[model samples]
Target: MIEIKDLHKSYKIGKNSLHVLKGINFSVEEGELVAIMGSSGSGKSTLLNILGMLDEADLGTYHLDGVEIKNLTEKTAANYRNKFLGFIFQSFNLINYKSALDNVALPLYYQNINRKERMERAMSYLEKVGLADWAKHLPNELSGGQKQRVAIARALAGQPKVILADELTGALDSTTSYEIMNLIQEINDEGKTILVVTHEDDIAHMTKRIVNLKDGVIIDDRKVKQVKALENV
Candidate 1:
């Protein structure tokens, strides 16, 4: 559902130039779960930003769900991103003062969805993430894993075509991380595409395909075994 070809991105640092992505090429099909693994400063997060349309490539193409987005206006790009993509960040970007349900409903508020309906949908997704009872709690009131679960519910509330997650389990303990990963795997099995960027090998193994990045280029792309379910583990 996403395609990138000869993607190049760079930034200027005074007199010198820093190249973040060097002619990167990749594609992700509908319903596929993919992982991008790289070391620190290896540009995997930069790639994820480009894929999520949060940042633009200096040169090359990015097409999402068949629309060529490289030439879109900022307004248009934001609109498209809201409609077609869901994002989960390593920090679990929830507002400190907002309750879990409110955070999940925030995106819908921007879309002009009415309060009652938005709350209903948000609650449904919170239930899906096993956090319905915790919906009234604020981010600070919840544990790291619980906050991430709320973030996942928020991402799901949009019903977007693809989910782009960057180090989703990075802040959690092993057991909690496994629980979150299994939730993502369940969503993937139900037909949403997922592209995760992680440094952990066990997290990378959760996907159907792995892309290893080094020096801002794709070094390896291959299919691997799916991660066993948490129950199985």
Candidate 2:
């Protein structure tokens, strides 16, 4: 469902350019749960940003669900992002003042979905994440895990073709992380293509495939025996 060929990216630092991703290439099929692993500055997050169309690659190709992603007008990129990509961040990124349900409904607002329908869909996703009971609670009222769950529900409300999560479990305790991974596994089982960017070995092992990155290049790509997060939780 996603393809990248000879992807290269760099950033300008003063007069010199820092090359971040060097000739990265990979394809993620529909319904696959893949983890991209790397240490800091290994280009995994750079890769995720490129995949999410948050940043353009200096040179390379990124095709999402079929369309080539390069040189897109900001407006068009925003449109495609809403249409095809869902994101979960390490920080949860929930608005402090908004209730869980409203945060989940924010993306739909951008899509021009009406209020009633937006809340309806958002509530369904909140329920999917087992947060329907907490829908009216504000982010500050929820715990870290709960906030992340709300973020996941918000991502789901967009109904994106692929979900790109960066360090999704970084902030939570092991039990909470495993619980979140269990939720992710369940989502993947239901046919959503998912990619998680993480440095944690246990987190990576939870995915069906692991792609290792070092020094801005792919070092290893292999399918692993999936470890059930529930068992660990």
Candidate 3:
């Protein structure tokens, strides 16, 4: 569902240019779950941003769901992103003033979906993520995991084809991280394409394939056998 060829991203810092991605190339098939591992300054987040159409690449082509996005206009790209891409950041990125249901309903507002139907869809996703009971709660009333669950619900509410998760478990404890990873795995099992950026090996290992990045390029790409049985819940 994602095809990237000779991708390069750079920014000018005064006199010098900082190249964050140096001609990186890779592809992700539909329904595939891939983990990207990298240390600080390795450009994993930059790659994710480019893939999600949140940022542009200086060179190379990016085809998402068979459509070339590198040349799309800003409005077109934003429309495509809202339709097919869902992003989960290290921070939950929820609106503190809104209720959980309202937060999840925000994305639907841009899609022309009717208000009643949007709320129904958002509440259904919240129920899927085990956050139905917390729909009326605000961000301040939740814990890290609960907030993350609400964020996940928000992402899934739009029925996105690709989920770009940047350090999704970075803000939670180990136990919460494990739970969150399992939840993501379940989502992937339901046929959503997932690309997760994480520095933790334990978190990376949860995915079926791993891509290791260094200095803005992929150093290793390998498939992994599940080390432990995933919970059936």
**For residues 1-233, what per-residue lDDT tens digits would candidate 2 score against the true structure?**
99999999999999999999999989999999999998888999888889999899987788899999989999999999999999999999999999999999999999999999999999999999999999999999999999999999999999999999999999999999999999999999999999999889999999999999999999999999999999996
Candidate 3 deviant stretches above 4 angstroms: 227-233
Residue 5 in candidate 3, Cα distance off native in Å: 0.5
Look at candidate 2 and tell me the lDDT of residue 127: 96
All models, RMSD in angstroms: 1.2, 0.7, 1.7
Rank ordering of all candidates by TM-score, starting from the highest = 2, 1, 3
What C-alpha lDDT, on a 0 to 100 scale, does residue 193 get in candidate 2? Answer: 96
Which pairs in model 3 have colliding backbones? none
| 1 versus 2: better lDDT goes to | 2
**Model 2, residue pairs in steric clash:** none
After TM-score superposition, what is the CA distance of residue 87 in candidate 2 from its true location, in Å?
Answer: 0.5
In Å, residue 20's CA in model 1 sits off its true spot by 1.8
Better of 1 and 2 by TM-score: 2
Clashing pairs in 1: none
Model 3 CA RMSD to the hidden true structure, in angstroms? 1.7
Query: Candidate 3 residues 142-180, lDDT tens each?
Result: 999999998899899888889999899999988888889
